[model samples]
Target: MDTAPKRILLIDMDDILRRTLAEQLSAQDGLRPFPVASGEEALAHLAMHGADAALLDATLAAQGLIPALRAGGLSGPLLLLLPVGMGVPIGGDDHLTKPIRLGTLLTRLKALLNQTDTQSASAGMDDILSLGPYRFLPAAKRLETLDGTRIRLTEKETQILNHLCRRGGTAPREDILDGVWGYGAGINTHTLETHIYRLRRKLAAGQPLVMRIEGGYRLATAPVPA
Candidate 1:
């Protein structure tokens, strides 16, 4: 068993609750909690000293906290504390309903962190990759054709393609939204469909590159033989 202390960052506006959670976490063996009231404070803390995972209030999620943390370079596990009856927010490793029990919180947090550790030990994709007839550059958020043509992609578009390329096969609509837009169940799937439509139009050169399968979508790297 891993004996190292796990540092967890908690972002919530509720001072009493946040402090209570922090204290509870501190009492546990091999657990450390860094509680903050706002996204700015959370980012600052991460910049100075990183945590193993982060938990955010669902209210803060609507204000773009998740994407901000990701843009700030926090690749660690992120969990959302949702209020009762609230729809699931976009972009988190996992979520729990409010009036959260300490036992449940700890259980979910531990699972997400463990998953992160396992994924980290595996191989990751390179910055540059080939997608269909273009050389995909995820970092640059652009694609290049052989003859020197370049296509700029929106951040969402780039994320969509990056995810599809990583899957190496058809990706379910719900999974694509969760992975690409950080949106989970109840969020409109039309957002993903619209992006796919635009991507198909942009990538239409001579053959269809992005194809819609029965369940989801896939990247067709080459045309099928006649």
Candidate 2:
């Protein structure tokens, strides 16, 4: 959304299909698809240039997209599509099938990318992020403290922080509690407060306050400049 059209990473080993799909998405919707022939190519592309959403074929040659996605931060709810039912491991952004309904695929892709963009922008305004001096990098999952110290948080911590930060202001405790910990475990647990306290200690970084609402915690900051 940042004045930039959404980007897509569409992978298809078939040359003709790759070109056709990429062109369709790019030309029709202005979604840039970094089409590649192999899963490795997708990984390489991600290593160098990342995209807002990824469309990985379930049958991509070797190692699949899941492993690479786990390494990189290309994961979101929409990050797991299984088109073709080859039964091979495929993940990161929902998948469809070999003969997918074009409209449905595009709709799902747009919704996912839109959600990611919204969350990212919300996080930007409400939190100082990782680094104290250098600011934060959500995509990279790295944080730097004010005194020039680096703190590399685990995937879990980063995800939890992202959830709170994206909530903007005033996320209810029950909501956060359910989000951070699944409803299954949350039903009989007092761990929510403990985790929040721990997250606060590690991520807050004396930024005045990371949570504004007393009932619960939400990434709270004055406001970003227009």
Candidate 2 lDDT over residue span 1-226, tens digit each: 2567666777767787778777778776557677887777777887788766677666652354565655675554323335454542422323355675667667667655655555545535344553223355555555665576665543334545666655653466667545543333235444445445555676564553355466666554532222
Top lDDT: which candidate number?
1
- TM-score for candidate 1: 0.59
User: Against the true structure, what is each candidate's TM-score?
Assistant: 0.59, 0.50
Global Cα RMSD, each model: 7.1, 9.3
Task: Assess candidate 1 and give its lDDT.
Answer: 0.74
Worst 10 residues of 1 by lDDT: 117-126
Which candidate's TM-score is highest? 1
lDDT of 2: 0.56
Give me the displacement of residue 186 in model 2, in angstroms: 26
